[model samples]
Target: MGMKYSDGFSKQLPTLATVGAALVSLYLMSQAMKSIPVGTAYSIWTGIGALGVATLGIFLFGDRASAPRLACIGLIVAGVIGL
Candidate 1:
């Protein structure tokens, strides 16, 4: 009777875990913001998120990066570093 609802309820775990991780995320984000302008925070956050997703994709899916991908990753790193 509850088979279909099981998947819906199970999704809460990831959602709650994300909320917890978000707290930790903001800590590093705060560190990233040190001496960085408020506007740059958006850039730094974007770079971090993109880099993490790309890295995870490579690790979990065995995705290969072309030269352009490497360059884009480099750019993201530089953006974070400069922030």
Candidate 2:
């Protein structure tokens, strides 16, 4: 019973972490954007979040790095950097 509960929680950890990170990020970014622009704020937020998720997927989930996956991840990284 304890093992099952722990397993379930473990399964949900990454999703929960992403949500938590996004919430924190949005609030912080909003504050920074108050004196700036929405377009800029959204660009930064989405690009950074995409890069973060891809990194987490690779590091935590033992995800594959096939050619297509690598290409997509590269695009995301470029977006983050370009932003």
Candidate 3:
């Protein structure tokens, strides 16, 4: 949605915000790595991100929530929990 904004100030603000968010996410992951194994932390981080984005796409962007897609999301949740 932010990326859909026109060029100039509008685009710059969203871009900056995105960069800031990515930086913060990395920082948090690094902090988590202090106690959790790197591989486990990274997997869980990516899995949760994927699940969140997919869920948001369904509710916010009217993306299809088909049975297969939902199953895949469930699998992601299971994998994250397994790790």
Q: Pick the candidate with the highest lDDT.
A: 3
Question: Which candidate, 1 or 3, would have the higher lDDT against the true structure?
Answer: 3
Candidate 2 residue lDDT tens string, 1-83: 22233465575766576567667877899897988688877887777766766677777777776889888878877876676
> Model 2: residues >4 Å from true position, as ranges?
1-20
Candidate 3 Cα lDDT to native: 0.86
Q: State the lDDT of candidate 1 residue by residue for 1-83, as single tens digits.
A: 12222455476666566667777878877986787776788687878888987877777767897889889989989888986
Flag regions of model 3 displaced more than 4 Å: 1-10
Per-prediction TM-score, please? 0.64, 0.62, 0.85
**Candidate closer to the true structure by TM-score (higher is better), 2 or 3:** 3
lDDT of 3 at 80: 95
TM-score of 1: 0.64
- Ranking of all predicted structures according to lDDT, beginning with the best and ending with the worst: 3, 1, 2
Score each candidate by Cα lDDT. 0.74, 0.71, 0.86
